[model samples]
Target: MIRDIFENAYAAGAYSLAGVVLMAISFLVLDLLTPGKLRQHLWADRNRNAGILVASNLAGIAIIVTAAIVASDGRLVEGLTYTAVYTIIGIAVMAVTFALIDVATPGRLGELMLHPEPHPAVWVQSVAHVGVSLIVAAAIL
Candidate 1:
């Protein structure tokens, strides 16, 4: 019984590691879409708002993955595969949605990321991330 428990724990660990790697990749994708490095903005520039938004995006991805794993139950391989696939799709959708938002708005989205002040647009962006995440999570589930 202990061995079974340990094996399940190991599987969960592996899948969680996969999720973390995917989130890192998603951050890179997001950074590329913007004018500046997101990590730089969150760290070097000390942009709290940017940090908040970026953190939310990461959380959004995590939420989807968590839901997927739960839905997958004991099927580790299937669960990890589904999580990775859906995450990639979610990232693509997010990039496109971000671009559309930039095009539809008055100012550059990248510039907004650099802004020291909090913008309503960031809130909207956060909502967009969650909305996309929920849809993707539902699909995976």
Candidate 2:
């Protein structure tokens, strides 16, 4: 039915917009936690460390989006609500995980993430970020 298709399209669009907005919010939160300007480091300097961290942040968001889609079970209202709720949770967990990792390591993760030096430790942290996201997504499902 055309109406069904339209509704599905609208739901998808809404979720997509929500995902993007959540990503921005996550970015701002992460930036605030760190020392340097994330935008400047990521854009002007093209710092790979920052880039890696940002990528990890995106992976966290992706996990929530996937979980949200599954939890929604093809319902528009459920999809929107689940995605929104899970996104916030996912971001929060990710920040906590990173902070914990920083505490365990030699230096602060927020500062380490912005460091221009490319190190295996950051890669490990990035993977951990994704790992935490998986756990959060699994809990949501």
- Indicate the worst ten consecutive residues by lDDT in candidate 1: 30-39
| CA lDDT scores, all candidates in order | 0.84, 0.83
The true-versus-predicted C-alpha distance at residue 5 of model 2, in Å, is 1.9
Cα TM-score per model: 0.94, 0.92
Candidate 1: count the clashes. 0
Q: Per-residue CA lDDT of candidate 1, range 4-81, in tens?
A: 999899987998898899899888887887676777888898987688678878988998888879887888888888
Superposed by TM-score, candidate 2 places the C-alpha of residue 81 at a distance from the truth, in angstroms, of: 1.4
* Stretches of model 2 off by over 4 angstroms after superposition: none
lDDT of 2 by residue, 93-123 (tens): 7788777888889876677777788877779
As a whole number from 0 to 100, the lDDT of residue 58 in candidate 2 is 86
